[model samples]
Target: MDTTLLHQYQLVLSSREALLNYCETIRPEHLAQPIPSYNNDSMGSLMRHVANTYLGWLLNFLQQEQHPYFTEDNHKNLPAIRSMFEQVNLVVNNFLQQYKDDLTAPLNLPREGETKLTLTPLELFTHVITHEYHHKGQLANMSRQLGYIPVDTDVIRD
Candidate 1:
């Protein structure tokens, strides 16, 4: 892999691990608490969404397939948060192994009713990471509103 792709993947993996650890620390009851009305998503839902989003990106990367929007089924049920986390971790591991040989190839991302968008593998990797970070921020906010401390392991800080 090129230096940029390698760095982006490393950052993604590290951030994912950190986010999972943070989620693990949250009290079980708090997991079900609803986020504010503005978002209307429960903490559990947001967590599941983050995992599903990454999984969707991974599926695109490994299978070169187009997937639908994020959903609970895709996340293996956020109500069972631990299992969901395990599923996400498994997907990440599988993705790393499957794409080990093509880390430098450009990605083919298809959009609905639009031309396909192409990005370097490194760019796609970073896009997914940033996507995760975006949702993770919302999760952190929900956690804090629910009176829990959020994890501080951001890629920028790391």
Candidate 2:
């Protein structure tokens, strides 16, 4: 992988760390509270969904493995969620190493009852990180709903 891409991913992780640290300050009940309007998605569930997207695309779809997705019951607390992201980091690192030679090589990913989805390694990486940021915004909004003022969790912050 290019050093630039690696550095960009590091910045992404740093922003994610900020979000997780903010989550640590929140009450467990607030993290677990279901927001009925948004399909009953709790903050924790959204975070897990982000992690699972990394696993689903990079690992399961890329490697053709059937890894089990994390459940709310199993990952009920911040530590468990952090650990899940640790696994995400590992998978991402492996992917970077594995595709260092051909980051732009196209991959035909399976789709249900449709044509296969084609993506390059770089595109896959971009997809996962962008997906995380999209949900990260939702998490901040969810925090506000639960009566907390969120800090800056972006890559460039004051």
Candidate 3:
């Protein structure tokens, strides 16, 4: 593996593990409960979005096609959300393995539409990291709004 890319992978993994640790601390019922008066983002909802993004960016548009969306029923359950998290790891790990040699190869993304943007594998991978962190912040805030102390996870722990 490329050492640089490997470092990125570890960072993503560390951050994700940190997130799961926090999620595990919440009671199952609280995991899915909407943060009252917050932006309607439950931890469950943000996680679903993050999980679905792995499928979309790496598995679908970047690597291969996957069902574009998870069924709505899949949302708002801790176990189900956790399953998605694992699935995200699977797809992303597979992607990096398959494309390690082509990190700079350019490709178009989203769809064959006029508005689609082009980026190399490395850039897309970086985008996924930043995007995950962006929503991770929201998840942390959601937990805080619901009265759970926020956990430090937005940065690489090691």
Candidate 4:
């Protein structure tokens, strides 16, 4: 793998691990607590949504594989949430290995009745990572408002 691509992937993986660790710290009882600004979605639901969105992007967009993993309704089930994380991790790792020498190749992501988007694998990786980071921050703020201590690791430290 190119040094730049490897570094980017490392950053993404580290951030993802940190976010998951923070989620793990959440008490099971607090999962159903409603978050501010989000109507009808609890902290747990949001977390699961993030995971499922990544998986969907990977499967439906990147890999062009029509998998029946995520749907609009079932993204919040505990089993689905767990599976989403595991699947995202596995897919990302595998994608990195498979395209280690082709980081510059454009990723032709399939869209629904639309033209595919042109993105490098690295770009897709970064998108997923950054998307997760955005949501994680929201979750952290919700946690704080709920009187919980969230993980406060800086990206530089990871």
> Best TM-score goes to which candidate?
2
How would the candidate models be sorted by TM-score, starting from the highest? 2, 3, 4, 1
| Model 1 misplacement above 4 A | 1-11, 60-79, 97-104, 155-158
Write candidate 4's Cα lDDT for 4-100 as tens digits: 6566767766776776677677776566677656776677778677767676776666787776665544444444556667777777777778778
Of 3 and 4, the candidate ahead on TM-score is 3
- Give lDDT: candidate 4, residue 39: 75
Q: Which predicted model would earn the best lDDT?
A: 2
The per-model lDDT (C-alpha) reads 0.67, 0.89, 0.77, 0.71
- Full candidate order by lDDT, most accurate first: 2, 3, 4, 1
- The runs of at least 3 residues in candidate 2 whose Cα sits more than 4 Å from the true structure, single-residue gaps closed, are none
What stretches of model 4 exceed 4 Å from their correct place? 3-7, 70-83
Candidate 3 lDDT tens digits, 21-66? 8888888778778776656656787778777877888877776576
lDDT (Cα, 0-100) at 25 in candidate 2:
95
